[model samples]
Target: MDEIVVGIDVGTTKVCTLVGRVEEDNSIRIIGVGIEPSEGIKKGAIVDLGAAAQAIANSVERAEHTSGVEITSALVSLASANVASVNSRGKVGVSGGIVDDYDVIRALEDARTIAIPGDRELIHVIQRGFVVDGQDGVRAPIGMHGYRLEVEAHIITALAASVENLRQSVASAGVEVAQFVLNPLASAEVVLTETDRQMGCVVCDIGGGTTDLAIYVDGDVWHTMVLAVGGNHVTTDIAHGLRLPIAQAEEIKKQYGHAIRAEVGLEEYFTIRPFGEDEPVQINRQELAHIIEARVEEIFSLTLQEIKRSGYDGLLPAGMILTGGTSALPGIRKLASKVMGMPVRTAKPENLVGLVDRLDSPAYSTSVGLLHWALSMSAQDLAPPRRRRMKGESNMNLDAIKNFFKRLLP
Candidate 1:
């Protein structure tokens, strides 16, 4: 029997719900997709519970109707400026002079003992790498002979209140939040290749309200962050610059937006009627590009700043992989490379089968990645339990150990 999985991506500009089936070859077939305009969400946080709930409900209903499956629990995408990450090391003595899965879990559990604030909630505890005894860079320690084991972990957290609000909104839609995957991490699942992870790369997901980032090195996450500014800011700038309504400004931006001013032809122009103007006025496309360029530059500048702040800016030899809605903007890859002084490429879901007519853009990377994550989690459940004793001694379970190894592996 094929296993079914669902992912609900609650983004700033839209909410996408995807239902996929795990085929025999482990390929994901997109069986259902629901895309709806987001309401009551700003910068990835819920501002109005009722509006957000209705929007999620509508998206879920559409997916259910298309796939003939009732949605229950789903892996949800999350992004907010309140999200933060930290790196720490965990250590544990090998129980039987061999570093087993149990020992690895204990090490990760030790890593999770950070002093987080009361207002924040822990989301992910990803093992970056492991060390056996004093030897560093041990990728898999299970069955290795060692007296001591250490694991380096990257921990992500978010504001408790914001998470609860978003949770309540999904709950209202009758869907349980199985896990909250950060936006850039989800996007990285779809866009980043094995080489990108083994080398260094940054996943930049520019959505409507939030710009999410994740830095990877040695096939593990090193750092992550979410910026409050995104494409909506560019649209807002155009609206104010042209004295037009937000809707009109958004339309024009989509139709004529460019991240580089020099790339736009000076003779090209578009017509739009601003407030208090009876007739439509011809607006220079260069002017619109100018407005967009300023905002897009600032966005990358901020991203670069954050990358530098994380101290991993120099490690990214693969540069950046750009995704999300705003990444579809014309000339964005060149502009991003120019501003960040690094190679950049735009990516989206590829090699998709079944109901994938609309999932071919960079905008749906996170939506599709959630299905991959769900599949991995399902695999973790089928992993064989360790045969050794010590059943009640450890606080962590066998499933948690398998999951930790899943994250630890490339």
Candidate 2:
């Protein structure tokens, strides 16, 4: 029997679920996928528990039907603006003169001991690098002989209340929260390459209610930030500027919004039928383009300032990789490049062995990445030499594990 894993992405605009099985060859075969319109979420934070739970339940039900499996737990992706990150360092003496898994874990724990605010909980303690004695840049010092060990890591923190609310919502949907992954971190796992990270890159996920930014350098996540602005704000802008209803503005933005003014012709025109108005109003493509360009440019400009504030602008030689629903907007990459003064390209999630057609879009990257995160967590939990069989294993247990695997087999 194989191991099954599930991933759930709870976003401001939607909830998505994905299920997959880990094959013998260590590849993931996706077997189920689902999405539902989101509610009770504002700026990536849960405002109404009941509404969020309902949305999650809807998405999970759809996935269960498609995959024919009862999912009880999942690795969830979180995109709240309440998340934050800081750098910390730790060092310890290698008593046995040998570095091992225990040493590594201890070093990480030591790094995590730094004082954080009472309201914050550590989300991730990513090991940047290890220094064995005086030698630096040791990716894995395990099994090496050294008298001292030092570790540099980034400690990501988030508001405990916000995280607890998310967990509660998932629990209300009848699913256990196996893990809570930071949204940008999960997106990076799928969209970023080793080369890109080594060369220095920024991953910008323009979500429905928040824009998540993660900057990587030398294959390490150096900085992360979430802006309380995203594609939804663009929609609101269109709604206000054109005097149209929010729904109509959103539709128009999806159908006609272009981030670069040059992409739209002055002669081209589109009609927006405002709600409560008897007649449809005609608007030039250039006019709509101008509105979109202004907002998108503002977003890019702010992103650039964030990079500068993070002190990672000069480090990003590979430029930026834009993902998320908003990245799908026409001409966004061009506008980002022009404003950031660096090369920019749209990114899609990677490393899936099945369901390529269903998981190819930027809108689903974070959800798909959540699946990858689950697999990674499972792998870490079952690291080599730790697999033990229970003495009284029963048929029921076997059936449960098998059923779980069957649901994930593509």
Candidate 3:
């Protein structure tokens, strides 16, 4: 029996369904991956339930065919302009002058007891770090002698209506949504290394309708935000500026778009089918680059503003790690580095094996991260290790795998 886990990434531009089998070393082996152009969704929110459901069904069917397994449920990525975040604290007294797992659980429970609005639902309550007896920056308290325990946590919230609509659409497709994982956290799980997190870094995922940002310091998430600007906005600018249709504009952007205008020679040109013109119109490639540059700069500028607002702006020395669909643009690294005044690099999911080579690209980062996040959380829910298991120990337990999924949901 294989421990199979599925991840569904519903984005503004496409819907991706991936089926992964847990291997002997607890790594993911890609068995099947399906993708199709997204419709009936906008800016990560469901606009038409029927259309969204059909897209989900088709993607899941394609993946199932390749994996030779029927997927009844999946872990979905949660993203939208409505996501919000806040930090809170909780404290509890230790029993027997020692902090135990139960005491840590109680402290966490108390930490999450903030007065969230009824209209908004809590998505995740992640601990930043814990303190024992007023001692700050305590990473682990279990088995430690302490009279008091305190926890500082970061809470993420989302609009109930938006999340419910997304869940309904997935349900309509006949697949249950096991949980709604935050998009930034998912993308960061695979892209950022532990050293990067410790040195402070920002994971920026440039999707079609949103640019998700997650900041980490000392190996804990300190800030997160989702901006309502992305690749689609740049495409729209090209379409309107060149009088080309949206499809053609998108094609031109991917085929010829550049982030820096100064580097592109003015003599280089690309042809496009302009509206009301029989023959194609020749446009200066430099001009196209200029148009893209403006929008890209604005996006980065807004991102910088958000960093400033976070007040942890100066903490990240490791700088930015860019991923997602839009980060594939040529010279994007240079543009981001120039605008952000920090080191910039592009990344995709690197912790993959088996039939997943095709998924080794920026566009598939979020999708891969979703499955990785689920597997990690599932591992955390297991019993603690007592020495090492025998060499013949079996890792394939379907009941335990099913229980893993059950533990993931709220």
Candidate 3 displacement at residue 127 in angstroms: 0.9
> What TM-score, over all chains together, does every model reach?
0.95, 0.91, 0.93
Which has the higher lDDT value, candidate number 1 or candidate number 3?
1
Measured by C-alpha RMSD in angstroms, how accurate is candidate 2? Answer: 6.2
lDDT of 2 by residue, 93-209 (tens): 887777655566667678888999999877777777789998998876766899999988888888999999999999988899877778888898789888998999999999999
Off by over 4 Å in 3: 382-410
Evaluation by lDDT, superior candidate among 2 and 3: 3
Tens-digit lDDT track for model 1 on 48-147? 9999999999999999999999999999999999999999899988978877676776788799898999999998889888899899998877768999
Q: Which of 2 and 3 is ahead in TM-score? A: 3
Instruction: State the lDDT at 354 in candidate 1.
Output: 95
Best by TM-score: 1
Off by over 4 Å in 2: 350-357, 382-410
Residues forming the 10-long window of minimal summed lDDT in candidate 2: 401-410
Question: lDDT tens string, model 3, 1-410?
Answer: 98888999999898899999988889898898888788798888888888988898888888899999898889898889899998889899986687655576677778778998999878877778889998999876766899999988888889999899889888887789877888888899789999999999999999999999999999888888889899999999999999989999999999999999999987999888899999988999999999999999999999999999999989989999999889999889999999999999999988588677678789888899988877876665544232323444545343453333223233
